[model samples]
Target: MLDKAELGKRIKKVRESKHLTLKNIEAAAGISATHISEIERGKTSPTLGALMKISKALGKDPAHFIEEVELNDVSLVTLEDRIVEKLGSAGTMENLTTSIPGGKLQARFIRLSPGKTLDEHPHTHYGNEAALVLSGKILFTVDGEKYETSQGDAVYYNGLEEHSYENISKKDDATMLWVSTERGVS
Candidate 1:
């Protein structure tokens, strides 16, 4: 069971959060607006290929959109459980959602430890990014502009700027949730 209902909810939320209309998704995913409507309504199920194409058009991961939620503990994301197996590894991310389930936004949950810095790959995804620091502290570098983040703080920046995160704290762990979406990124 793909949990089309839950997926539909996430899809709807993403669409609304991005301020995108059915026609926008239809244009991006090549899935018909009517079909997308049905999917959002949980009236129809999408095929894997259709789902993948839709995700690509919307700038998200097909896998993240289809995650099964635990009825026992709604806050317990199974994705997080998977990441716990390799807890201490820097750059380990427990994907919170397919980030931008459909449209122009994407989100991820990352855990970083002291002295570990993530990669500096240059990426030009089509959006801006907001990273919410949930715990500990991190040193963030966006196209050479450096900023430090701590619990209760968030960093927002342009997606066009190359960026990476580093755990500069020696005594604590860093947890961050990243949400990104935009009109365009150059």
Candidate 2:
């Protein structure tokens, strides 16, 4: 179940991402700015019709704001619970943590076959990232500097810098545990 306040926050986040102001939503949704503000503050709940109107105004589905999320004070995720995604042809990424409400941290395990690379184009995001090489070797590049790390080694860097990685081993697959924080709200 999703809490009303959480739902309101989701709405606010989506609206902000679209650069929509309360007045803009008011004009598009035919809802007053004051009422929208109240709904966003969780001071009052909007009816399904009003929610649909607001969703349409924001170019989103109403379900986006009302999707059910299971909440648990404690979450246990085993290897079997990991969600794996194939990257390109020779890499796999496994999400290691279940979604946590209001959580900012993410953990993943990445694997690259020998002679392959998780070649991310140089990009930056608002957060910090750390990776621990669990097996084989990696050529970790950050902001034009290259650092090689083997099993049992770790590297940490500000994610705002452009970065990428490559599996440098000739016969061994590279495996690493990657963790990062989510971007902070401005």
Candidate 3:
């Protein structure tokens, strides 16, 4: 069952914790800012599709907002408990951060299949992102500039840029440790 007010509060808390404005979510999720505002205020509920988009825009799973969890001073997510999501033909993403209140940093282990990209096109969101190549080769395109990276190489940039990456090797997969900070409007 869905609790609309609780859902709204969770969404609002996560959004604010990530330093995101309604407009930021709108740009990433393709939902209207007004509608997001209403949802955050508990004046309305988001549809399943809307929720999925909103969750993705927040770099989270929809369950992250809906699941009821207690907050603690120290949070730990064991390897066994970590959540993993498939990126279709691209490969997989394993979230490495604990789901604690006021969390602002997101860490993920991304595996990119050979010659595959995480997204079809370059995308932008607020905040800053950094990645360290752990295996194989990656070709990163940031704001139209191309950067070829190998194992041990690191890349850092503002998330607002049009950024995307692809596994450059046709015979091997590429892996990276990616960390990103949530953004807020001034």
Candidate 4:
């Protein structure tokens, strides 16, 4: 579940980093300055609509504000502690790393059953993505080019392009580690 207070803090941090004042956001997002201030102070939570408007005004994705990452010298994610979510109907994705405050990268471990596919048609995002096949085989398609990768193989590409993946093995499940970094952000 998402934490509202943490989300508010993250929004405040991003707003400050962008040098955006409450009044500026109010003018751009059509939200009241007092309401924005209350949200920043963690006294109130914004609705999805308000969050979208605030994100647009701040020139960021709404996820940038809602993602909760702990700041620590060393963070550990065990298999048992990983958060898993269904990916379409043929695969599952485990978030390998928690979002880091002010950080630009995210990582995930994806598993697909044999003959299953994960397709992202005409996808575009402001970042770069890299994947390493950990087991079995995978067919990765990027910008109309297809590359077959087996265990120990890896692929890297600009994320602002169409891409998709498939578990190409007949009987084995495929696993891969995916890492992506935000574009225009260090």
The prediction achieving the highest TM-score against the true structure is: 2
Can you rank all candidates by TM-score, best first? 2, 3, 4, 1
Reference-based lDDT, residue 74, model 4:
38
lDDT of 1 by residue, 1-186 (tens): 467777777778778877899999898888899998899888888888888877776666665577553221113346435454244556577655432223355567777877777654545555788999999888888888889888999999887788878888886778898887754545
lDDT of 2 by residue, 14-75 (tens): 89989999999999999999999988988888988999999899877676677686344345
Candidate number that wins on lDDT, 3 or 4: 3
TM-score of each prediction: 0.50, 0.62, 0.61, 0.59
Candidate 3: tens digits of C-alpha lDDT, residues 1-186: 448788888889889989999999999999999999999888999999999999889877786666666344356778898788999999999988875645778899999999999978998889999999999999999999999999999999998899999999999999999999986532
Better of 1 and 3 by TM-score: 3
Whole-model Cα lDDT of every candidate shown, in order: 0.73, 0.85, 0.88, 0.84
> By the lDDT metric, which is better: model 2 or model 3?
3
Task: Give the runs in model 4 whose Cα sits over 4 Å from its true position.
Answer: 1-70, 120-122, 183-186
lDDT, residue 28, model 3: 99
lDDT by residue for model 4 over 1-186, one digit each (tens)? Answer: 357777778778889988989999999999999999889888889999999999899877776676554454235789899888998777899988764445677788999988988764546577999999999999998888999999999999998777788999879899999999985422
TM-score, model 4 to reference? 0.59
